[model samples]
Target: MKHQPINGQHHVSMLTKDAKQNLWFYTEVLGLRLVKKTVNQDDPSMYHLFYGNRNGAPGTEVSFFEMPNAGQTRKGTNSISSFSLLVPNDEALSYWASRLDSFEVPHEAIVSIGERKSLTFYDRDELTVHLVSAEKDNGIELVEPWITEDIPPKYVIVGLGPVELTVREASRTKAVLEDILGYTQVRTVPSMGDSKVMVDIYETGKGGLYTELQVKEVNDKDRERPGKGSIHHVAIRVKDVEELTEWAAKITAAGFENTGVIDRYYFHSLYFRDPNHILFEIATDGPGFEIDETFDALGENLTLPSFLEERREEIESKLHPIR
Candidate 1:
């Protein structure tokens, strides 16, 4: 049976120890435009910052939560091993490498993944990040010198590229991505242990940025504890709000408890989990980053959702000052 696929890449959110440091790295160093700044609805003390291309568009954003003084996370089974970002091309990568060196940020030389080249590096809090030159044709806008100059933000993001996750039961998690999420098994490659299997699901094209679920050999199985530098959630994109609602029903029918549609200001969202315990969200592509702020003024200040607007004073008081 052919299953309906979701649309573009929505966003990926991470937990951070220092919001200010992350803001500087993403905005000043990485060249991602800060689109929105708000607080966690449930826990207003923590600030939620969204960074991406020109306007924090879907498939381009990498959001973060500022949880000050959070504990360290264990890198093992049931955790997202690594996350990747797609740059425009090799030239963009070279530009980034030189900039990182100038900033005194330590990073490895380019590494090859098939025809793709990547610069693997760690964030200030130790979250693994990869800036890869993807083969996809992304028409999105990009800020050149990702660290130095000011350029108009681009709209192209090759969706979410290959999220590497660590899981004890590889086959079970693979089933969820394939059978439930409609992802197709692309190929399997040898990794540190058994074999690194890759499953891909695309809404736009065959290639481009897709999720990569990796099964790592672990000595034991354990629940992942939330901590600083951990991926709080990885969001996949659906075409629109209607598709998001359909996925909510599909996810619940599959026996996983799903959070119904959520208004994330820019887009609606639904969240569920795979058997391996990684949190996943299905978000819409409409009502984009420019819904509230103009394209030019994207990452300028704190932007709040209407629900949190009434409690702005309380939220600001709780969050630590992050310049």
Candidate 2:
């Protein structure tokens, strides 16, 4: 049986040093809504914050891990080179340029990427961010929530953009993206060095939910050490639970180890590292943020999965309140 194409982004998870600062950066500065308030299951000592468009749609999400004193990430080889978001048009991009300026946020002047225009900036943790005038995303349609109603609807960020993944070799990565993940090569552009970089645009068309796998000719021996400002994993969207299983089979058959299916409460997930050891995830798009709270009350209080319900008090106490 044939399955759905891996759509655009499900979510991009990154590490941060302070939850409060990260919260302010995404929610207040970027005007995204904090839809989920929870702790990192792997390490309950840390906070896992989910920020995205109005209702926290799959492709729109950008989640963060908050660990104090974890240090900052160093940019080198085998890392997620860039992450971007989609706005409606150049006007929105201009508004962002001025909005960021008002906050004294240092950012790059608007730049063009392929056919789209974009403004680049850095979060408090120094993680790079881009706001692009998106093309058209024909992927799974989403009801983009404008939770921050005061912000102009046209200027609000709709979803994610193509994220660049850096790898030492392109052959294995190419095979995995095409055969295993089922992505088509959209275009290749001349980059800084030799061997043009491959650009794979998803149905995330207009929104730029694409992936740019950079083929590095020289193997830099220095490895990436994860801390603040580093991407934890880049997740691509799947239709549902069953499709996730199919992905697991295909991935394993291709000789990559995966985390199988994991219940993240809101959505199901399967994780595997790329040839470059950059973490990648395939996540379902359903049973989203509303499953736990009313649409109006999202991010208002602490939320725990059923297993962690008993320890809610302890968990709440440990986390410094951001809301």
- Highest lDDT: give the candidate number: 2
Q: Clashes per prediction?
A: 5, 7
lDDT by residue for model 2 (1-323), tens: 56667776788999999899889888888888898988888778789999887788887889998889888677766777668887876788888899899988988888665665778888888887777676443432434656474578878887776676666665666667777776666656533221244444323223334433333422564676777888888898888999899988888887888899999899999999877787888999888999889999998888888888898888877778775
What does candidate 1 score on TM? 0.85
CA shift of 67, model 1, Å = 0.7
Q: Which one is best on TM-score?
A: 2
List per-candidate RMSD values in Å: 3.8, 3.0
The residue pairs that clash in candidate 2, if any, are 54-145, 135-206, 136-206, 137-206, 161-208, 162-208, 162-210
Q: Which TM-score value belongs to model 2?
A: 0.90
| Window of ten residues with lowest summed lDDT in model 2 | 202-211
